[model samples]
Target: MYRKYFKRLIDIILSGMGLIVLSWLFLILIIAIKVTSPGPILFKQKRIGKDRQNFQIYKFRSMRIDTPDVPTHLLENPDQWITSIGKILRKSSLDELPQLINIFKGDMSIIGPRPALWSQNNLADERDKYGANTILPGLTGLAQISGRDELSILTKSKLDGKYVENITFLGDFKLFFGTFVSVLSADGVAEGANKKNSNEKK
Candidate 1:
């Protein structure tokens, strides 16, 4: 009952409140990003959402307009494309704040697996096999706080499946708090994106 109803209700309420409360911060970052980088303020990319559907996940633009379509791990020099402000935004996870819109739009939730990149066929397939794709993607999740970019795609898929099996108000609370701690500590955020998944093409 909670998964089908209350969860989405919570998503809408919290995300709506969050946008209202964070509007000032959003404006500030908008100005900062524009001044520091010559490009759009929001970076939109296709990601696999619930049921293998595609949706545009949003982030504050942290890279150059001409940044390649590949994941950061695939980029030969991700840092070169990152702007001066992007560095701070990424380190602070401010780059992801815009995803509150995704949650509000019903494309994501406050807790679930991070949406897979559109090109992440292996990740999506693994999640689908485990039925993890049945749930909305999230702003943060168990795997995110546990290891973020450190864990392998398969490992992440397993953890994501586990989360689906164990979804509960308490579990979600734990993940939410854990994510807060992780963000504050900047834990598990692989800046160089060195982790490799088998599905990635060289």
Candidate 2:
């Protein structure tokens, strides 16, 4: 009942309130991005959402205008494309604040599997086997707090499947709060090209 109905209700209410309350911070970040980078303030990318639907996910632009559209892990040297303010935004997870708009618009939930990139065929295929793609994507979820950028696509998809298997108000509550702790400590964040390099080494 909660998953089919009340969860979305909570997403709407909380995301709406968040947009209003965080407007000031949004403006500040907008100015910061403008001052530091010469590109669009918001970076929109096609991501796989509910039932593998395509949707544009929004984030604060953290890379230079010329940065490639490929995933950061695919880049040979991602740090070269990241701006100074972008680094802080990525680490603090403030870059994802715009996703509240996604949540409000029903493209996402406050907690669910993080959306797969349109180009991430391997991850998408893995998730299909677990039925994780049947639900809306999220601003953060089990895979996010568990390892963020550190986990392999298979492991991440499995965790996402686990989350789908046990969607509940209490579970969402814990994941939501747990996200804060993960952000503060910058847990499991593998910066850009390093992630790729590490995997190659492994």
| lDDT (tens digit, per residue) of candidate 2 on 1-202 | 9999999999999999999999999999999999997889998888899999999998998888887767787787788988999999988989999999999999999999988888777888999999999999999999888987788888988999999999999999999999999999999887556585122100
Candidate 1, poorest ten consecutive residues by summed lDDT: 193-202
Q: After superposition, how far is residue 64 of candidate 2 from its true place, in Å?
A: 0.6
Tens digit per residue, CA lDDT, model 1, 1-202: 8887888999999999999999999999999999987879998888899999999888999888888767777776678988999989888889999999999999999999998888888899999878899999999998888878888888999999999999888899899989989999988776444545422111
RMSD of 2: 3.1
The prediction achieving the highest lDDT against the true structure is 2
Q: How many steric overlaps are in each model, in order?
A: 0, 0
How big is the RMSD of model 1?
2.5
Task: Tell me the TM-score of each prediction against the true structure.
Answer: 0.94, 0.95
Q: Rate the local accuracy (lDDT) of all candidates.
A: 0.86, 0.88
| TM-score of candidate 1 versus the correct structure, residues matched by position | 0.94
